[model samples]
Structure formats: C-alpha cells, structure tokens
Target: MAYVGTFSPNHSLLFSGTKHSLQYPASTRRGVVVVVRAESMTTEKLGIKIEKNPPEEKLTQLGVRKWPKWGCPPSNFPWTYEAKETCYLLEGKVKVTPSGSDESVEIGAGDLVVFPKGMSCTWDVSVGVDKHYNFE
Candidate 1:
C-alpha cells in the first residue's frame, strides 16, 4: 500500500535525503516527507538520517529580520558531530543549552554565535519569532 500524508509504519522504508527542507509556521501543515532507509545510515541503531545539501543560490538568498530555531531532540542528539553554523538573531531571543552543560546563554538581535554538533542545547524559542536559516 502507498502511504500518504505524514504516516510512517514501523516496517516502512524511505531511501532519500532532503536537498532542502523548509519548516513553516505549521498551521496548514501536510504530508509525510519520507523515511530513512536501513542501509547507508551512519548511526543505524541510533536512528540518524543522512541529509542532502541544498542549493547555494537559495541559501545565499536567506533574508534577515526573521526567526529561525534549531532543535536537537533527545532521541536524535548527536554524540560527537560538528558543523559550522551561522546564527543571526533577528528578533526575540533564544537560549542554547549545550551538551554536558547545565547553563545556557540568551541571544538577542545582532548576537552572532556558532554551535557545533555535539553541543546539546534546549532551544528556548520566544512566543513569535521566525528566522531564515541555512545549515550546511
């Protein structure tokens, strides 16, 4: 049977990666994107998925004065992964709680910082804030 719209069975298998996935405000959300394949997954037992890259021109066009949030779920937390990220706090504020750390820092507008993969942090998002994000 062909599954549709945000439904994934236990035995379901999806072999693909996101060239780019954009998260919206989520009121009119629809459909299941895809599932991870059994093979080619770096952290199989850990349930990690391999993601594809997005276009450069599109990324470069990312606008400012928006709210963007990055979250690392307890289930998908990377043990030791590293990626250079560009964080431009356009509005409101965000707090990142890194891995193995009990404290977090609040970042507001014009506060630019970088967080590596292994860093575990509970992203505390403000009531209404969205940002244009491009993570490599």
Candidate 2:
C-alpha cells in the first residue's frame, strides 16, 4: 500500500503506513494531518512524464518562465533527447509516441512535461505549440 500525506510544520508528529498511525512528541499534544492514497502513473516504460495542469507554485519554483521558449506549427517529427529536458507548455496540443512503443502521451497547455535523456520519440503536433523548456 502506498500513501501520500501533507502536514503543517507546526505539527511534530510522525506518520507510518497506509493505515496511518501518528506518534507525537512528549511536548506536543495534537495536530491535524491529511493523508491520501497515491495512484501511480507508470513512466518507467517510456521514461516520459506528463504532469497535467501543474500548480503555479510548482511552475514558479522550476523557473519555467526563465527557460528558453520554443514553438512549432502542426507537424510530425522524430526526435532524440541528448539530455534530459523539462518543459512547461503555454499553449497548443501535442502527442508524443516513443520509438518502438504503441503507447503515446498527449500533452497541452498548462502541462509540465519531462523527457529523459537518450529517449527517442516522435512528436505529433496537432495544434501549434508554445512552451518554455530547459535541458539538464
């Protein structure tokens, strides 16, 4: 079982397991904790990750606006990443199909996407794309 949880720093408590158990420090009495079960999105197969409608705080933290911008009209092309690439889409839609794999991922505006280094994939742009991208 997998669990995801968030708590305020004011709480001095530890949580363990899917069925969460809380242990508080001797000095602290009680606090509020929120826990949710995690649903896994499998990215290990293609090494491509698409985060849909990521929070503005996450975008700001990644400095997405500071990265270089790239745009392309509706088209299809093959690309291989020499380095890991992270990008935030501002507009348009795209479908990326990895080489030798039938599965494809669709991404569009308000999405944060990551392409692992050495990945070979096809970019099928149905709508023009405008994005800020960074290579690491």
Candidate 3:
C-alpha cells in the first residue's frame, strides 16, 4: 500500500503504487503562510490544481492576506495566465478547460487554486466569480 504523510510544517510525501516521492514545500518558519502544490499521478498534466478542501480558517486567512480582489459576472471567456496565479474563491463557480484538451476542472467557492504560467485555458463562468488572486 502507498501513503502520503506530512513530515513537518515544510515537507510532504507523494506516494503512488509502490513508489514514493518527496514533494516541494513552502516553509512555515518565517511567520508567513504559504500554499504548496501537490502533484499526483493522474492530475499532473493539467497544469492547474485545486487543493483538497482547505480549512475555512485557511481560506479566510488567505483572503485577508492577499491582494487585488476580483469579481466577474456570469460569463465565459478564454484566458491565458501570463504568470503563475494562485487564487482563493470566495463565491461562484467556474470550469477551466485547457486548450487542446478535453479534460476540465470545476472550481468554486472555498477553493484554493493554482494556475501555472503560460497555461492556455478557457474560463467558463457558471455562477460568476468572486475571489482574491495573486500572481507569483
């Protein structure tokens, strides 16, 4: 059996089948909060990831500590990330489909998402979007 475990505040493991890999960590030592990306075998190619149901406090703290809050009315548009973007959704829903791929991921309220740089994706806003975003 495979398992994923957190070793410290700064480290985590990625396990698939019988193999294990060490994932990159964002240090929690400097009195700062950071969100680290988790890579799994199946979802690795999308270049966009949504964290697995972050705690309410974590989501609230991210909004309070982030910049440039945005709201978009219900609509659809194609957007390309010029730089790495990490966003926490406070309300609304959206489906992002990468260009040339049939797979899509739905993002909604209380979700923390990371979109990598140069990723070409179309945004399908289903219930509008309200979120706090920051580019890395």
Candidate 4:
C-alpha cells in the first residue's frame, strides 16, 4: 500500500491517507515553502551537506551577512569537530575526506557546508581558504 501523509512544520505527521486521497490545502497562512521527500530520495550520502554554486540572491535570502572570517594558506591537515559546524565559503578550494575513507568532497567559494559533530576528517586546502563559520 502507498503511504501518504501530511507533515507539520516540525515534521510530525498530522494526518494519513487511507480511504481518502490526500491533498494539500489550497490556502496556507504560513508563507514557507514545504518540500517533502520519501526516504533515500537521493543516491549520495557522505555525511556532508552542500549547497553548491548557489545564486547570490538565494545566499542573501539565507541571511548571509558578514560573519567572523577565517583564512588559511594552502595546507593539508587532519581535524575533528567537537560540535556541528556550518560554513559559507567566501573564497578558495578544499577537499575533505572522512576518517578511514578514500571518498572526499570538493568545496569552493559560494559553497555552504555542514560538518557533523564528532566527525573526523582531513582538510585539504588547495587554493588557500577563507570562510565564515558557525558552530552548534
């Protein structure tokens, strides 16, 4: 049987479609756009979230304000995060590979990345690095 349901803003299931077909309400007081995807909708899963080559307008909408900046010269180093980290790259290129894994992610300017807490990774800053980061 096909599972159908509506989720609230907090992602809790509000209702399910069984005998009746499911449909979204024509009007909603909330202006936010909601996207619902079934499990394993995408193939890639590397524990890193990236918004690649995002447009300036979308970045602005994400509240990309001037943040405390950090920079480093071209280098390679192993690192581990004590807490979750989110960063918006301002400039440079980087490759991050998870511990005991050969697979790596290429990151550059205009890329938004989230590194999970307690993740052990190696950072390869190829073209130097400059970015704004926040930890949670």
Please give, for residues 5-105, the per-residue lDDT of candidate 4 as tens digits: 55565434443442322254535423534334333211223798887655666556766655577889999999999999878888999999999898998
Model 4 misplaced regions, further than 4 Å: 1-45
The order by descending lDDT is: 2, 4, 3, 1
In order, what lDDT does every prediction score? 0.40, 0.78, 0.71, 0.72
Q: Which ten residues in a row have the lowest lDDT in candidate 1?
A: 39-48
TM for every model, in the order presented, reads 0.36, 0.67, 0.62, 0.62
**What's the C-alpha lDDT at position 35 in model 3?**
37
**Using alpha carbons, what is the TM-score of model 1?**
0.36
* RMSD after Cα superposition, model 3: 11.6
Whole-model lDDT, model 3: 0.71
In angstroms, the error of model 4 at 133 is 0.9
TM-score of 3: 0.62
lDDT of 1 by residue, 89-112 (tens): 444455555556666555544344
Q: How large is the C-alpha RMSD of every model relative to the true structure?
A: 17.6, 8.0, 11.6, 11.5
The list of candidate 1 runs beyond 4 A from truth reads 1-82
TM-score, candidate number 4:
0.62
